[model samples]
Target: MPLFSNVPALRLTLAYAFHDPSSLLPHQTIPTLLSLPLPLGPSLPSLDGTGRKPTIRALVLDKDNTLCPPETAKLHQAYINKIEKVKECTEFSHSAHSILIVSNTAGSSPAPEHEAEAKQLELELGLPVLRQHPDRKKPFCGPDILKYFKDHGVTDNPREIVVVGDRLATDVLLAREMGSWSIWCRNGWRNPAMPGRDYRGFFSKTESRFERIMTRGFGNTAPLPKAT
Candidate 1:
């Protein structure tokens, strides 16, 4: 009974598609892959358009929820180690240019504060940060963002990209649109209605269906996200 799905046209698509997280939060949502031209994975989707498993290439990470809490000025100390370990994880180890932060800083108070924040984060992580100006923020994948990726040299194949974030409407949906993979971090912005979190009372048909889709069938491997 979530507010977004009351529309009659969406019920059937909600039933068969759109799944829950079977693996640990932020590991990677498998059901998001159902729309892919090929099958879902035990291995990664081929990025070269050759139907072979591709090594992880570029990562477009969300900042606020996935790496740190929202609206904070500094990088949370608790997540510093967790972020470092991402390089050590089985999938990633790309060159410095390959890892990018694609977070929204449009709403930051005092306007340019987000730029300073991005610089500070870049210094802390030793990685390039791409904090979008509010004018071209997330859920949009504006020309600037895509142009940055192109300028920095991502694979021509979009499937090689991986998006990690807390919101489905932004992070996951953006990746889906790009034909890339997505991971939903249950750790972000703490919404009761987020994919895996449970809420009270008789759930609406939409909410129940959403939970059912996102909670099951993933294989666990991702580390528990440490909080700030």
Candidate 2:
């Protein structure tokens, strides 16, 4: 039996599921669910961008909040520190990994300020900026990232790439579709009301959930699985 054979019925029920919100409850307060931190066993060694891991060859990152805080007041210094940290992490590992910045700045013809920002980021991070135009409805969803890797001659399977970003809708969704692992930086900007609102939490919670789900089917120590 194929999966989703009962999907049609499920969809029918879901379509009218929200027709009567009042019928569900009367001023019911949902209990605040707090996620407990899991112990990082000694078996799980520290990951500092090095280590001969069996997976994740490339690191694709989002610039805005994942790398640096989004505060205009301290963006410059924060960015510089982020760059240094990235360099240190990558160099310490001594792994021949490629770093790419996938960002949503202006479109092809970015404003003067946007251009300047991109240039600054590029210089600081020592990586090329793959800025997607805002007008491009699905900026990251389009073939921008895939085309990037192809153009750069990255023939490895999508599973070999890891995407780190702040937003779940953009970064996580794109990674899922492309079959790439994703690291959601909890300190960045995010939308908590979306479908996966549960994911928006303290860094510890997000990291713990991510580790739990990814390690489920794979071996215990397997590098986190790509989000789907």
TM-score of 1: 0.60
Q: Which tens-of-lDDT digit does each residue in 153-195 have in candidate 1? A: 7655565666776555556555654556666654343332343
CA displacement after TM-score superposition, residue 224 of candidate 1 (Å): 25
TM-score of each: 0.60, 0.51
Report the backbone clash tally of model 2: 2
Candidate 1 error regions (>4 Å): 1-27, 30-52, 88-92, 106-110, 131-133, 189-228
Give the per-residue Cα lDDT of candidate 2 at 28: 10
Candidate 1: lDDT of 215?
53
Error of 2 at 221 (Å): 16
List model 2 lDDT by residue over 1-228, tens digit each. 011232442242233224421111111111110110111111122334456333444556665544543422123444455455554553223342356766654222366766676677666556666666554322234366666666766535675565666544445444554666555554453223432434233433443354445345432432333333
